[model samples]
Target: MHTVVCIKQVPDSAQIRVHPVTNTIMRQGVPAIVNPYDLYALEEALRLKDRYGGRITVLCMGPPQAEAALRKALSFGADDAILLTDRAFAGADTLATSYALAAAIARIREDMPVDLVFAGKQTIDGDTAQVGPGIATRLGLQLLTYVSAVGEVDPENRRIIVQRRAEGGVQVLETALPCLITVLEGLNEMRFATMADMFRAARHPLTVWDREAAGIEDITKIGLKGSPTVVSKVFAPRPRTTRAELIEAQSGQPNDLADTLLAKLFTKHPQLGRQIVRRSS
Candidate 1:
């Protein structure tokens, strides 16, 4: 079985700051790391590779610096890494990103057939969660989102089963090979990189593909021209000013404390008490 995992290098959200005047993200000094959610997908793919004894390729689309993200995946035992970077892919929204990724994957398929593709549920910077589904749609692959666990894989039969997370419970789904899965976090723990693997990753010759190399025929379908979504504004939320109120009772007993709390709540908001009474009646 051959698997391809997609990952993105994102600015650390913890250290991200908003520009005061521009009301945009200040990424100049922010540290970049692999998207945390994508790590779960990568680990899952690595686990599959370990069990099935197949090659795993890590794919990423970003600037040249994003090669670091692919190398990180390599350190985790991926067999190969591919970086899709070009000026034409700049300022791409989810649609354009999916288009470019789908094209690149098709190019990869020409060389070696890909049986599975994995991605994170969403990116931290862009929580839209649309790119994976978009890629699946474009590639005509079975789309599986919010996958909690992979249950079984029958390579001979070209069938696979997975546990998908739903609104109230989990759904067990069976699909054919060549499916795309957007995995939820906590699917599996990432393995620690061995010193040998780390050295190998540092020295690995990464496959870098520009637009033409990635088999992008239409220039208009990538980058800013293909992106239709517009960000109206970007700003930080205002800090809340309300403070918590403490209720005290002389008795300091649980029952006394409950009564005191209810009395204070009723006194402070008479409408709440009336609503409770009305609902009970």
Candidate 2:
């Protein structure tokens, strides 16, 4: 019943700004916080830990500054926290990120066998939503995405059931153990950390691992060299120049107002009016 939750430190979206000249995200001086979506996964893992009485480990791969994100997870009663950081891991795309994460998890498995791994559906910064699935593919773990609820965990039978979100309805899926779940937002609300837990988090010794420590053997499979996707251009949306025109009805009646609006619309765009009539006919 050991669970590993993957979290990421992201720039607060509310404070994020685009550079005017460079047309890129202005991360400088932006406050960093744990990806909000990941909190749902963490809270869900905590709930499972409370019920099953098992240890939970919070893992993250980022720069040294990401240690704060791991410490925050510690305050939420995670049994352990691991930060995987290295220069080789920088500028990694989803593929490289998943590769590094999968390697670290394998390293962690040597000490304590991990039964389940939880992660957010996607990161705020990188909304590609590919990393979790990539990790599952690389690790050969059962992949379950957009899980709204975890139904049952039968460790003795080595099976688990979950409610996943689909297009029209929810799907109840029964999967085997050692599965990777990408939790959707609004699954559970995060709990407040107790004063004791806060103190413990402050004093807790974090396990920091570099590339070699995390057992990443393939040098060519990490960092910028491993990233295949490239951002060619980023720019702010152009401001709209068109202004709304007001249509007035003297009588203020619904039919009159509609007629006035339609008249104005037809006068403004005769082709649109003809298209509407053709569609109706």
Candidate 3:
């Protein structure tokens, strides 16, 4: 079984800087880290590989620097890593991102058929959570999102049982192999790398693919041209106009302040004061 996990490199939220002219995120010089949500997905995939005995592959789509995220996953025990990087892939939204990853999965299938595809619940910068479903839909694979646990896997029967989180409660679902799952967080813990894993990742030759190398035939469908939605504008939030009124007591008496506040509150909203008094009573 070959488990493929989709991960992303994101600008650290604490250091997000917006472009003054375009309002787009100024990712340059921003400390990039693996999407925190993706760590849960990667950890879940690693758990499955540990139980079922197979190789795990980490896949990411971003600039050349995104190789760091892939290398981080490798350090945590992923068997292989692939970075799909290209100028044509810039400014891609969720739809285009799904298309590009789907193409890469197809390319991987040629070598070793992927038994399972995993992705985080969503990206921090782009919390669409649509790409996983889009890939599953395009590839005709079973789609499972918000998975909390893998209850069982019947390799002999080629079927797996999983627990999925829903609005009101959890849903127990059964699906076959070659399924795509967007895992929920808190399901498993990421393991620490041994010295050997760290050394191997430091020297790991990541497979970098350009548009052509990734078998992208339709340039329009992989980048800005293929994205349906556009960010028309981004602006800073406006500050609130109103300020809290301060209650003053001439003699610094707490009871006097409370009485003045009560009078002021009743003057502004008599009904609210009535309700408060009733609740206090």
Candidate 4:
């Protein structure tokens, strides 16, 4: 089986700072790391590689700086890494992102046929949870989202089974290979890199593709123009006007606090108070 794990380099959420005027993230000083959620997907792909004895290829779509993310995946023991980057690919939403990735996958198939594709459930920056599904849809691959575990893989039959997370509970579903899966968080821990792996990754020659190299003929379809969604405006969330009121009383008695809160609530909104009381009762 040949497995492909898609990864991304994202700004550390804690360190993300937006430019006041430009409305763009100030990534210059911010620390960059592999998308945390993608780690789980990588580990899962690695596990499958370990068990199935196949090559694990890690792929990413981002700026040139994103080569770091692919190298990190290499350090984690992924067999090969590819970086899909072009100025035209900038500011692409999930739709356009999936277009580029799917095209890249089509190119990858020309060399070695891929059996499976893996993606993180969602990107922290985008939070759309759409790319994986979009890729699956474009490639006509079976789509599996929020997969908690891989139950089995029948290579000869080109089939696989997985445990999927649903609203109520887990759903065990079986699908065929040449499928795409978006993995849930905390499903698997990343393996510590061995010295040999680190050396191999550090020296590994990466395949960097610009628009032309990525076989992107339609310029409009590859980047901002091709994207359907538009971010008309992005601004910091306004601070809430009202702040929490602290209740201070004799010895901070709980019963007194509760009663006082009820009284205040009822005075402010009698209907709301009645509804709450009725529901509690």
Question: lDDT of model 3 at residue 59?
Answer: 94
Q: Which stretches of candidate 4 lie over 4 Å from their true place?
A: 18-24, 243-259
Clashing pairs in 3: none
lDDT of 2 at 144: 98
Report the lDDT of model 1 for residue 133: 97
Q: What is the TM-score of each candidate against the true structure?
A: 0.89, 0.89, 0.90, 0.91
Q: What TM-score does prediction 4 earn?
A: 0.91
- lDDT per residue for candidate 1 within 41-125, as digits (tens), equals 9999988888887899889999999999999999998988999999989999999999999999999899899999999999998
- Cα deviation in Å at residue 224, candidate 4? 0.9
Q: Which residue pairs overlap in candidate 2's backbone?
A: none
Give per-residue CA lDDT, model 3, range 1-281, as digits (tens): 89899999988988988787676778778899999889999888888888889999899999998999999999999999999999999999989989999999999888898989999888888888999999999889999999999878888788989999999999999999989999887888888889998899989989998888888899989899989989887786665988978899898899999999988999999999899999999
* Ranking according to TM-score, highest score first: 4, 3, 2, 1
Model 3: runs farther than 4 Å from truth? 17-29, 251-259, 271-281
lDDT, model 1: 0.93
Residue-by-residue lDDT tens digits, candidate 4, 1-281 = 88889998988888887888777778887888898889999999989888889898898998898999998999998888999988899878888899999999888888999999999999887788999999999999999999998888999999899999999999999998899999999898888998988888989999987778777798888688989989888787888989998766686899988888878899888999899999999
RMSD of each: 3.3, 3.1, 2.4, 2.3
lDDT of 3 at 23: 63
Clashes of 3: 0
Give the Cα lDDT of each candidate.
0.93, 0.93, 0.90, 0.90
Cα shift from native, residue 40, model 1 (Å): 0.9
